[model samples]
Target chain A: MDNLKIEGTKQTPEIDFNSSTGILSISGRSIPENTFEFFNPVLLWLDEFSSIAPEKVIAKINLEYFNTSSSKYILEILKRLRIILKDGKDILVEWYYEEDDEEMMETGEDYEDVSGLPFEIISIDDE
Target chain B: MAKQSIYQSEIENLEESKNFLKKSDYSKLELQMEFKKLVENYEELIDQVKIITKISDRLQKKLNKTNIALEDSNIKLADLNDQLNETIDQLTEAKIGRKAATIVMIVAIALFIVSEAFIEPIIDNMFPNNFLVGLGLKLVVAILIKPGEDFTNKYMLKKARKEQLRESQLSHNNKP
Candidate 1:
């Protein structure tokens, strides 16, 4: 499987998925103009990755901000992770938020509850 | 949506499901098992969609805030830039006035020196002991001092105003 790497922008986040390392990371703000178009490819790649089924898949999501459409896509990403979880694979979702960002922390909790997946809600120092 | 449009999609979904009842012959027990399984899958999909919609909405709000902050910063930056340009223009005007004053003072001093050294001696010889010509020449420059400064000030101000007006007009036209 080829590694997936996407650069971050003012309106979008960065995506760095390493096939060899089994560590997928998405960080930065995500407020793309068209959420569906931006995330469709990323979802497809994850689907392909799930088939190969890496020994341990770790997904780290650290987002400062994201728009409504981007939020929907994020849920889709977590849903994909749930599928991998069903395949008897070890899946870890580490959700990082700013220390002072209570809203982001709450948002993470919502995802954790709904996905029914083990999610680690971590806080980092504010920038 | 209109009444017909609301039923359109639901009717389509039911029609597709009806195909199973039309062509397939199944035992009563088999039909019950299949219906239960179909309901289970649909319930799961609906739950997943619900979660996705909730989370996605929150993220979108955050994104909108970031955009608002960026716009506010841009407005502040434009205001500061306008203030800086105004100060620079005032400073330029002050500098021009200082230079004009220095030039005028230098010319007045040179005239006084020439009148005292050479013109006074020649005039005294011609008029036979008259110091009035020397006094008159000094008075002319002294009288002209204020007018000379006024001319310089008026000229510099006109030039500055012309340039400033063009800049202000250009900026106003571009203002959002």
Candidate 2:
């Protein structure tokens, strides 16, 4: 499948999906006008990727912030990753947040608890 | 969207009921049944709405933050570009200033040579007794030097101060 790459914008996140290397990265801020439209493709891509995932799938998510709808979509993403993990593929979710964001840290924790998947909450340096 | 509106209206009605519920006169069983049913439904809806709304709003907040962040990044990028342009302008100004100073110095030297070598002999021929005109002209140029340098220095300092204040104001406004 062709890699899915969307440029980051004021209202959306950057998506870098490499089919050859098998390292998927979602960075920048993600606050889209229509949550369903922005995330549906991501969901579809994950479904395709899971079918023929690499031996190891590292999904790096370095988001500055997101909306509630995006949060639900994030949960969906984690749930998909969990499925890939259950398929006996080595899966790791690298959740990057600003060091000073207490709410974001708590949010990551909440997702970790809910998803029951291995998550690495990495603190990023302020720009 | 209609359902969301309904939820808001329901919450509003509940609030209104809470206000008048104490004053209304009703039989014990009537009050118990009405209150219990309302409370039970309210509690359940609140729980469901709580989860839905929480997820909804958190995602909204995330999107809002991303927008603000993108704007901030753009502002920072603009500021850096302005600073770079200013630096380039300063460098160009300094280069032009150095060249102007050199040209002025050369002109002064040429004027000195003309006065001493060519004009002194002519002045001597014109006025045998008084040649103070040459001295007076030289003195006027000499007197203008310090004030001219001071004016240039003060003008540059004021311009720099204005730029600093502008940047500071921009930073203050951006803080939030």
Candidate 3:
């Protein structure tokens, strides 16, 4: 599968999914005009990647902020990863938040609870 | 073409139902099927509402937290700005004070020169060597120095304030 790379914008996150390395990263804000349109292709890609996924899949998610609709799509993305896990694939979610952002840390915990995925909630200094 | 919107399918479903009701006969079986579809749609709608509401409320909390942080930062920024303005004012006063003193000193020197070159000769003609009179004239000039410096300081300060206001206005207008 071709690598999926999307540049970040003021209102959207960056996506860098390398099939070879089995490392998918999303960073920056996610408040797109159309939540479904923005995430549909990502869901399709995950669906395709599931069948031929590498030995280990690491999803690095470092979002500064995201709207409600984007939050739903985030859930959808995690649910897809959950499916991959059910198929005996090794998958992990690395959720990063700023050191001072308690809400973001709690949000990562919430996603971990809802998605039933192994998550590493990491904190880093704010830019 | 842009991707189909998330709501498109839901909207089309509603439209189809509306058209069916308008054109089709009121048969029992058809009505039952239509009602079933509507009920299913309603259930899905309710599920979506639940999810959206939960997420919206959570996000609202996050927004409130962010707003509080922003307001705190703004307050700190305003405090810093006030301190900066005070420092600028102090520096401006010091600079204007020096300028005013320099101007007053130059004027005093010119007055002294004029008195010595031209006015002292006339005084000598009238009084035949009145040392006290010359001393008094020089003293009068010396006395005026303080007031001259005061006037210069006030004028320069007013001009500086006007320039500051103009620059502020220009910046405000230029802001995007």
Candidate 4:
């Protein structure tokens, strides 16, 4: 299947899901006008990718800001990743946040606990 | 039309379970299995609600902080803009004052020249013995210099302010 690449905008995050390297990345702000419309395809893509996933799959998430609805979608994404893990694939979620963004770090921890998935809460330098 | 929710499927599942429970089922195993499914769904739903609420609250706090910072920055910017406008006004006033002085000085010089070449001769012809009239004309010209400069300065300042208003309006109109 062709790789999924959605460009980032002022209101939405970028999504780059590579089937070859199995390095799925989501970055930038996500406050789309319609959260379901924006994330439905992402969830569908994850469902399709779960079957043909590589032995090792890494999901890199670096979001600057997201609204309440986007938070639910983020959970859904993690749940999908958990399924891939259940399929005997080595899955890792690298959640990146700014050094000073304590809220984002705590949010990542919450996801980690809720999803019961291996997560690396990485702190990155602020631009 | 109503907007679609992310929890539509979960809600549909719950509705189905409710409909199934309303029926008097024959098999105990089937009811037990359905109860188990209901419990699982409820647990998952609770977990989702818990996590989502926590995250939403944290993010809202972050957003509040950002908004406070932005407001502070805007206040600072407004102060800076006021200072800049005051400086520009002072500069424009000084510039117009200088131009007005120059114009008044030139008019004074031209009046002096005219008095010396034409007005002085005419006065002399009219009153050959009176030197006071010529001196009085020069005095009047000197007296008018201050008022002339004041008038010029006021006119230039008014024009400058009108131009500034026009430019500001043009910029405001041009903004997308």
Candidate 5:
């Protein structure tokens, strides 16, 4: 149950998953050259985390942009969280977008509809 | 172990199913099982297609928004650059004008001193009684002052432009 921490890059997002606190946060752009390679480890980690997950898990996602392939992997992540919810775990997704980014806000709404996870779509000022 | 790509796995599965159908030696029960597996794969593929299409379209919208923002930033940068160049041009002209004025004034002073030291004696020897001749010489120097200033101004302006161009080219080359 070690924490998962990845530094953000120009083309990839940062990943900070704290098992102890049950606060999983991902932020920044995600346009990796190998989407599968980049996300496969994340999936593996989630698979392990499912059994040992805390009483409450909060996933904070603040993505500026992501490619189509990354979108699939995002769904896969949500699917894992859905499995946790099925196990009677309390979980929620906090989807953050910039104030002016209508597209991002709508995309968050779409994920909320499809993933069946309680989502809070929050808008923040541009940095 | 390296996992197979999604498309590769799908293609391999489809090929295997096709081969299974082509083989005529399969029993009825075996054929039904194989068909069932194929149907299952087909359904999963349809589900993947549904999600991928929706996500792809939404991501495309996000990309379009980013592209528009980038274009707007570029336009603003270009406008600011134009304003900066205009200011540089005005400053260069002002500097050149001052330098030209200084050179003309220095030349006029030198000419005045030389006239008193050499040209006045020469005038005395040639036309000592002719005040008009001395007046004409002074008038000639006064007339040349304007053209001298004009030449100096043009030369300085050209040099300033060349230096500015070289500096801009160097900056362009240095940019990543």
Candidate 6:
């Protein structure tokens, strides 16, 4: 499968999913004008990746902020990851938040509970 | 057109299930499977709602706190700007006062020189017995000194304020 790469903007996050490495990363703000349009390709890519499932998959998510619709799409992405986990493949989700952002840390915990995926809630220094 | 939603696919799936129950002719086993699927979907939907609501509210609180901090910073910045402008005005007034004093002193010295060289001689030739006229002329110059300095100070301050206003407007216009 071809790797997926999307550039980050002021209103959107960067997406870099490498099929060869089984490493998926999303970072920056996500407040897209069209949530479905922004996420549909990502969902389709995950579905494709699931068929040719790799030995280990890692999803790194680091977001400063996201709107409500973007939040729903994030949940959808985690659900797809859960499917991959159920396929007997090793899966890990690394959720990064700034050190001072207590709310973001709690958000990662909430996602961990909701997704039921193995998550490493990591704190990063503020830039 | 209907507004696009992130939940559109989920909503469609639920509608499909509803329609299947209303119209599909299914065996008992098929019915049981469909019911299970429906329950699972419903459970997932509920979980999504619960988590999304919790996250949205938390982020909203964070946003509100940030806005309050931004407002406080803006107020402090405005206060500092006012203080700076007042200091500049005070400095400008002191500078203009000094300039006005210097100009008045120079004019007083020039008048003294002219009176001694030209006016005193003419006065002595016309009124040989009266020495009070020369002293009175010098006294008039001294009396006008305060009002002359006051006028110069007012003029220079007005000009300085006008220049400051013009520079500010130019800077505002030039800002990208």
Candidate 5 TM-score, C-alpha based: 0.87
DockQ (Cα-based) for each candidate: 0.27, 0.11, 0.27, 0.58, 0.39, 0.51
Clashing pairs in 1: A66-B59, A67-B60, A68-B60, A71-B56, A72-B56
Please state what fraction of the native interface contacts candidate 1 reproduces. 0.35
The 10-residue segment of model 6 chain A with minimum total lDDT is A44-53
* Best candidate (score: lDDT): 4
lDDT of 3 by residue, A12-51 (tens): 9999999889999999999999788688888778888888
Give, for candidate 3 chain B, the lowest lDDT window spanning 10 residues: B1-10
In the predicted model 3, the residue pairs found to clash are none
Best by TM-score: 4
lDDT of 5 by residue, B60-94 (tens): 97788778999999999999999999998999899
**lDDT by residue (tens digit), candidate 2, A30-117:** 7798877787888888888888888888888887777666776786688788988999988887888888765576677677777778
Candidate 4 local lDDT, B22-124, one digit each (tens): 8975488988888899999999999999988999999999999999999999999999999999999999999999999999999999999999999999999
- The DockQ value obtained for model 6 is 0.51
Model 6, B1-176: lDDT tens digits are 11246777678878878888897488998888889988988888899999999999999988998899999999999999999999999999999999999999999999999999999999999989999998899999999999999999999999999999999999999999
Off by over 4 Å in 1: A9-12, A33-37, B1-53, B71-75, B113-134, B160-176
Q: What lDDT score goes with residue B77 in model 3?
A: 100
Which docking class does model 3 fall in?
Answer: acceptable
Candidate 3: Cα lDDT at B126: 89
Candidate 6, position A10, lDDT: 97
Sort candidate 6 into its docking category.
Answer: medium
**What TM-score does prediction 3 earn?**
0.79
Output the better candidate (1/3) by TM-score. 3
Candidates arranged by TM-score, highest first: 4, 6, 5, 3, 1, 2
